[model samples]
Target: QVTLLQTVVGAHDLFDVTVQLQPGGGIFQTFVRGSGDDFSVVVPDVTRVNKYGRSADCTSNNEIRPLCYCKSNLMPTSSPSSASKSTK
Candidate 1:
């Protein structure tokens, strides 16, 4: 099974996210900003990486190069209070 091993948040105002995959060897990274929307990344044979807004999905792939699926929802501003609540 694939798992999210590590993640790093960016310093800039822009949302920069990086995720490390486990069980195999794959890395997924992305940046998000502006209106709320979804974005997808298709690697097409290695593995599928799904990124939602500032969140990232990194998973290992058994195949040579699988398709990556990334979805994101951008917002005008990020609310720290709301984020904290979700963590709990």
Candidate 2:
């Protein structure tokens, strides 16, 4: 199963987020920088790594590159007073 690992308020309206897939799963290191509704996602491997987003790899007889990234739309949601978000 995939789980959210960390969330830290950063400077310049940026937030650091980390997600880990359990039991030998892919680890996603993502960054979200924004406030309120709209946010930007920063996936460093978005270019090189194929996660079925931005770039993709489908299995076939001619070419077979397994998907190495996990897709789970998880975000932090709670009062700032509590540590609802888990951290690494």
Candidate 3:
């Protein structure tokens, strides 16, 4: 969960965000600046991002689920060759 601290009007919309981490009960605050579809972290630089992988089968309330990728998601849902042999 995050709370909006302040918003500044300029060329781009600048705002302060305070992130309240669940489970561990920690706090992370940062400045996010962007306009329209573009946005980025401006200070502290503590955020970690996962760039590659498949979608994770995580619960809706999991905070980091959006950034997670599970190896199980890479596995095929079913094998066509195996299914054919079994049917025969």
Candidate 4:
């Protein structure tokens, strides 16, 4: 199971976010709602890239799930010699 860092939300428990992929590839903007135990929005799961983002506004009923943005690895740089320390 995933372990949360344990945080408290204000009376309105939701936050908006805008994530940019490595090398400024693309931006992922969304407002995840709820504690992530059980929350969802309209999405197609039969295929890949199956996830939805926030609704038109905060008052909308269709709220996406809450998730903590993180980084597990580094993206490649334009430099051919750009290298990272081995994780092994």
lDDT of each: 0.41, 0.44, 0.59, 0.34
Best by TM-score: 3
Top lDDT prediction, candidate number: 3
Q: Rank all candidate structures by their TM-score, best first, as comma-separated numbers.
A: 3, 2, 4, 1
**What is candidate 1's TM-score against the reference?**
0.25
What is candidate 1's local distance difference test score? 0.41
Candidate 4: tens digits of C-alpha lDDT, residues 1-88: 1112222357255544445443223345444455658643223221112233331223334333222122322433454444333432
**Model 3 Cα lDDT, one tens digit per residue, 1-55:** 7744577656347877766554333455678888789988877454423222235
- Once superposed on the true structure, which residue ranges of model 1 sit more than 4 Å away at CA? 1-13, 34-88
* Rank by lDDT (best first): 3, 2, 1, 4
Return whichever of 1 and 2 wins on TM-score. Answer: 2
Q: Give lDDT tens digits, candidate 2, residues 1-88.
A: 3244245644666655555544224445566767789888755442212143322222333232233322222334567556545442
Question: Mind giving the per-residue lDDT tens digits that candidate 1 earns over 1-88?
Answer: 3234232255333444445554233465555433347533322223246422223234344242333332322224659998899899
* Candidate 4 Cα RMSD after full superposition onto the native fold (Å): 13.9
Could you tell me every candidate's TM-score relative to the true structure? 0.25, 0.35, 0.41, 0.26
What TM-score does candidate 2 get on C-alpha atoms? 0.35
Compared with the true structure, model 4 gives a TM-score of 0.26
Alpha carbon deviation, residue 34, candidate 2 (Å): 0.8
